[model samples]
Target chain A: METRNLTCINCPMGCQLTVVTDGGEVVSVTGNTCPRGEIYARKEVTHPTRIVTSTVSVSGGVIPVVSVKTASDIPKESIQAVMDAVSGVCVNAPVSIGDVLLENIAGTGAALVATKNVAAKQL
Target chain B: MNKAGLSYYDIVIIGGGPAGLAAAISAKESGADSILVLERDRELGGILNQCIHNGFGLHTFKEELTGPEYAARFISRFHELGIDCRLNTMVLDLKAEAPSGDEGSSNGCIKTITYSSRSEGLVQITAGAVILAMGCRERPRGALNTPGYRPAGIYTAGTAQRLVNIEGCMPGRRVVILGSGDIGLIMARRMTLEGAKVLAVAEVMPYSGGLKRNIVQCLDDYGIPLLLSHTVTEIKGKERVEAVVISEVDENRRPVPGTEKEYECDTLLLSVGLLPENELSRGAGVGISPVTSGPVVSESLETSVPGVFACGNVLHVHDLVDYVSEEAAAAGKRAAEYIKGGASAGSDTPCVPVKTGNGVRYTVPSYIHPDKAGERITLRFRVGDVYRDCAICVYLNDSRIARKKARILAPGEMQEVILSGDELRSFPDLTEIKVCIEAN
Candidate 1:
């Protein structure tokens, strides 16, 4: 059995956790004060992901653009590719908050949505 | 008058941290000549030097970089612009010279700065405009009133970070960290990597104050534990830290009687909080924001006093160094404009006060000028606890100007929301802006 030391991040009590594992499966987790730490540790040791925020080009807008972010965490390694996909896309103005820009980005089941509204550029 | 001995500059910024350096660069770029930066430390990086962790620069640079790397990018530009920088100088005081009808010029601003090397005992400078960027200081154990015996192994999170990352010194063989701020969380992993056993991180708050990424990356990967609603009730040891008593806390944050548990450890690290260094600003009689504990400023980053500006951690605690540099650049550019006689054209409009309501601990830029054109106001705030699926709203006199949904909000990380001038213009008679958490 291999033992690992983890810091619980689910809450402020950064508990120094000890996870006992056999092969690839977790056996017994100790030192966690909350259930979130166990869930966090399981995901971290198996698969880790993060949410990404970036700007998308918008035409005919008062500000010429708006900021957007992924609705969910995507694969850690696929963030760059998703950013590349976002870099080439542009939306027309009159975009409102929570407007979907792209869905299932890089097959990560994450949706890119607008964070603010930008009026269409005046002719 | 000793006018011949004094060199007049358009703006003189004290400290060469990200804020001061950025201010100088902006002031110079905005066509203000005679701009000088005074840094007491030999290096220009400031607190960024001790922060060797990643997860910075996502907002401004669009790429993640280490703290020093982010600082180096700005320092390089500062050098390229040939901004006059004097290292090893400390600013003593700022005094107003004369009452000026023109509100933009800092001509009456005089600063008495002191520095001592092998040669010079002290030096001073007077300038047209002054920007306070002295940054902040970490809270120590004395402030926490920690019920513990005085021990040799207890250290602040920043001190431990400096010792380990900068000086390559090992803090201890076994560690117990108090508070779950970013520094504390990072140090837990640092000590573990250095082959030390971290017993636990105790937090008085019900939630973690650090970023979600740090929680996962620093703690989960290593199997560290976090105890919510728990705190270190007592410290045990005489000459050295040998053990700490942990207890569960109730809603009132008082330790419960029967939940006490003791763990043996050799080191205790505190990462409680940071307070802004605003003595210079206060000495100059600049109005301070109760929320930020910094200067209250308009959209142009000008403080309550004319010709004075503030930015970086001095303005408000920031989660990312990139934003600090970004905001500092704005303050720098505006200071330059003021020196060049190109300040915004208008009478000083009365500012509406902003307050923190539910869930938010505090908010920066406590005052707002609705008439300012194209000015984007950034409100930096901290939540009171750990909240998930919460909506943060900015309300102006009962009207919701902006609202954003957050998946998680922790006290450890600072949150920022920008409101454009166009939004402010919609409510011409705006009396106040109140930020509060709608749901958690």
Candidate 2:
């Protein structure tokens, strides 16, 4: 059995989590104030994941860029590829929050959606 | 201020950030019909608009959200509640009016807010209650007093955030961030993601002021070195940034004679500290604490000037926006109650002073009004230094009333102790309470 420690990012509490694994299988989890922390630890030690946030160019918008993030947490190792995909992306103005910009972003199975609203520039 | 330009609002929130938005929503829910939110920016959401990062809305919404998503939730809610707001409005002055001025007088004063809007020009509004949620601003290079010539490439972390996330413009390709505050650490990653090389993050304090997770994900993940007990001593640049001289400091935080290294970088970002924007608070005659550099608020979040309340970063710099929203909602509710109650605390009200004990730095709601402090009041404070395996103790007068065990405590992180009003009401002669940290 092996044990590892991780910080729960579910909330601002950032609860410290401890997970023990038995030969690549689940054993037990502790030191979490909430159940989500335990769930996070179990997945984190197995297949780590992260939500990637970035900005994409907006054409003819009130602002030059609109902030975006993955619709859900993607595999941690795929963050760089997702960013690389995001770098070449651009969308039209009047982007609303939750608007999907890239489907299956970087082939990570998570959609990249706009997080901020960007109004179209008035002529 | 002309009479024709005078408007009326039951409550006027000074800023339309997360704090102000939450306050306006709760105020409307609390039955204040006329509430106005003033935002200086082109739109609402304040700094959150520029903050595109995830890891927000954990407590309030129970889901990890990006900054804009978190703000959009509140913005939608605020809109659903039919709250009124003026965008591109800058509040120029806040003043207390109609003070009785007599000793021991409890006739709470009215508040007047003067603001300039791009559409409406300068306007003065009479407010039955004012909630200060102007938030805070980052400390500039002048605050650090570092030996440097004025250069164009130096920007505050927040400024860089806006430039990158909002304007889609990169500040520079090579960056050296000063101070390991969360903003600086986050920006180190942001600059990196935007294709800039973040050389290092230097903090004067031994420990990073940012959250442990930020240190891990932002700096450690990117392989960016965090130089603890070090700071940028000199800026060697003229027109644009050329380089920054980093030096180690001793126990007194004074630069050591021989330990210095130079980093060739085009941009320098400062995240040294944040100061609560208090010029408006001071103009309103709110008693400011030298420690928090914020208003001395009571349990009801009421400032020294009656009918005026403060919350969010304006009250004290909170690490979490969730806490700010929680506090602002309370302030809004209290302001609504103040309007409904229509009476001020007289000379008979209890002024229970809440003081800091060993290891505690300062606390909000410095005074607790036993009668008015709802069912539970969360006393938030920061510690003076780091501690492990410690206990937080609350002493009423001389008797220790409550104690909670803490695994660890740090100056960078804000801590809280919940006190029940019933507990305080039980103590009839309670004069003061002190919160302290004890080694376990």
Candidate 3:
């Protein structure tokens, strides 16, 4: 049996949860004060995923870059691959919030979308 | 603009952020006739415009949203209400009008707000009630007083956040952050994602001032070390930051001798703390609380001035914008009641002074009027330091009124204790309510 300690990010309380697994199967979950913690711990131990938020280069905009995020959570192990994909992207202004820049990033099936609007610079 | 140019409104909000927007909505819903929101920025959202990170609106919207998305929800509602708003306008001064005994009202004082913008040189707006939501600002390098040369590469964490997230400009390649504030922790991950090398994050306190989730996702996820009980002693560079000398600080926060270590870096980011912007409040003669550096207010959020109210960061720094919105909404409702003459005219009854006891930093709504106490009243406060397994106790004139068991309490997080008006009314002639923490 192996034990993995995790902090449940469901709420600001940040409950410290312990998940005991035997042969890659979650056996017991403890230290959770809420039901969501159980769901989070089970998923976290088996198939961890995280939403990626970062900035991308922008050209001819009032600002030099635009902030972007994965439309949905991606696999935890694919975070670096998703970030690498995001680093290579350069979106031109005028970019609007929720505008999809990349589809199926790093094969995680999550689109990268802009979170803020970047207006074009006026002459 | 002359006094004749003064536009009369039932309520005038001093900001256009989440707090102000929520206040305006509440006021309008409370049967307020006219409302206006004056924003200094070019757009509706304030700092939320540049905060593109997610984790917002989990409480209000029941789903994670980016800062801009969270702000847009309120902005849309504000527009739907057709509330009058002026962009790029800065309020210069606020003065209360002398009481004119005209109607059956007890105290009648209209507020005169002086504001200026490029379009309108200077305009004085009159309102039956005013809500102060100017928010707070980040503590700068000057406040730190470290032995450092004035350098171009040094920036406050919030300024760097605006530059990178909004302006899309990289401040530097290599970075060292000071103070471990929430903004500083968020920026550490931001800089790393932008391909900038983040060497380390240092905090003078043994404990971190940021949330544990941020420490996990921002620093730990990126493999950056957080140096507790450490601080930057000096900055080395004439034009830009070249290196920073860090030293371990004793418990008393004094730097120890012969413990200096140098790290080569091009940027230094300070995320020390935030201070409530209360110049407008002070100029208006509002009572200031030394503990909060904000306005001392009543349960209805009324300042010393009868018609002036304060909420949001201008009242007290809040860890979550959700609470700011809620508090501002309450202030708005009360201001509307004041304007409509629905609230009680005078306070003949004695008011209770809420005091902070051991381990308590400060509480919002510093005073409480027993008669006006609503059904559910929340007393929000922060701790001076970290404590585990503590019981937060509330005393009404030496009698235990309420107690809440906290699994853990940290200065970075805000704690709240709720009391019902019926319970408070039960204790007549109560002079004070003390909120404190005791070990379990």
Candidate 4:
């Protein structure tokens, strides 16, 4: 039997959830006040994922960088690889928000989209 | 418009950030005749322009939006409503007047705002009501008083953010963050993505001052160490930061002896805390709260000076911009009511003071007048420390009125409770409403 303790991130409440499992079979969930906490705990224990957000260098734009984020949550383990891949990527000016910067990043099938609109510099 | 050769407005809001923008829009919608927003910044979004991170507008827009996107939504609405705004204008002083001894005058109260701008020399505008939304400023290294030589490598977390996001310049190649503020955590990830090495984040508090999600996503995911109960004791550098000495702190946050650790870094980022920009409030003779560093406000968000209101970070430091918008809207509505002659500063109605009990820091809207508080009142507060399996309780005149169970609570996050006017009437002689956290 194994026990896992986690903090729920669904809201500001930050519920402290404890999940007890025996050989990968769920035994009990405690400390959760709502069903969302229960579901968060189970998914957190297995197949955890998170949406990655970062900035990419921009050329000829009003600003030097544009913020981007994964279209959806990606595997937790691929966070670094996704960041590594994003580090080398740069976009041009006139990039609008929701514009895709990378497709299928780190084999996670999540595209990186621009989070801010960067207009071209008036040179 | 009254007074010879003086520009007059029904409402004058002192900001153009999300708070001010939302306030102007709400005031216009609430039927204010004339409104103006004066902003010191060149743009309308304030800090949101550089805060490019996602996870904003979850409560307001019902969808995930970036900081700029969220702010843009309000800014667009502000323009759509044809609200008057002045950019790059700085308010130097504010004064309240009581209609110049004309008791029978139509205007009962007035405010004079002295401001300056590059294009427009010195200007003064009088208004019937004013809403303060000047926001807050990050605590700088000078406030920390760390032993260090005057160096160029040290910068506030927000200043570094503006440099990286707005100017597209790197503050340093190697960085050491002094506090675990949210901006510091987010900057850790930002600097890493921008090809900078973040050595570590040292926090004097035992717990991180940032949100748990930020800790996991920014530090834990990035493999950056968060040294809790530790802080930078010294900065060792001549021209620029070359190294920093970190030491473990005791329960009182004093550095312990013989626990010093050194790190070689070119940059030291300070994110110790934020102070509400209340100098303007003080200049206007507004009563300030020693705890919040904001104005002492009533249930209607009216400051000590009648016809004057305050909200947002100028009122209290909020964890979320969504709440700032909500609070600013309330202030805007009240300011509009004051202009429409529907509100008064002095009321004979009994007012109950809201006090912070053990384990809590402070509450906004320090006083509540149940008679004029409308149908409901939302009280927002922060905890002093982390608590597990705690119950947040509200008492009116020593009788428990509201209690909610929480699995965990932390100082970094602001919590709120709602009390309806009907519920407040239960205690007719209510003198105080205490909000406290009790260990379960």
Q: What TM-score would each prediction reach against the true structure?
A: 0.75, 0.94, 0.94, 0.93
Those runs of model 3 whose alpha carbons end farther than 4 Å from true positions after fitting are: A57-65, A90-96, A117-123, B1-5, B99-106
Give Cα distance to truth, residue B93, candidate 3, Å: 1.0
Q: What is the Cα root-mean-square deviation between model 3 and the actual structure? A: 2.3
Off by over 4 Å in 4: A1-4, A18-30, A84-93, A105-107, A120-123, B104-107
| 10 residues in a row with least lDDT, candidate 2 chain B | B99-108
Among residues 3 or more apart in sequence or in different chains, the pairs in candidate 2 whose N, CA or C atoms overlap within 3 Å are none
Candidate maximizing DockQ? 3
How does model 4 score by TM-score?
A: 0.93
Q: Model 2, residue B53: what's the lDDT? A: 93
True contacts kept of each: 0.04, 0.64, 0.54, 0.46
Question: What does chain B score (TM) in every candidate?
Answer: 0.91, 0.97, 0.97, 0.98
- CA deviation > 4 Å runs, candidate 2: A1-42, B1-5, B99-108
Candidate 3 per-residue C-alpha lDDT over B1-440 given as tens digits, one digit per residue, 9 for 90 to 100: 32566678878899998889889989988988689999999888788887878888877888888888888888888889888999999999987766455573434777788999999999888887889999999999999889867988999999999998877788999999999988999999989887899999999999989887788778987899999999999999999999999999999999999999999999999999999998988988889999889988888888888878888888888878888888998998998998877764356756888899999999887888877887978888999998888899999998987778888898988888987887877897788899999988
Better of 2 and 3 by lDDT: 2
- Answer with 1 or 2, whichever has the higher TM-score: 2
Instruction: Tell me how candidate 4 scores on lDDT.
Output: 0.88
Top candidate when judged by lDDT against the true structure: 2
What digit string (tens of lDDT, one per residue) describes model 4 on residues B71-100?
878987998899999999999999886776
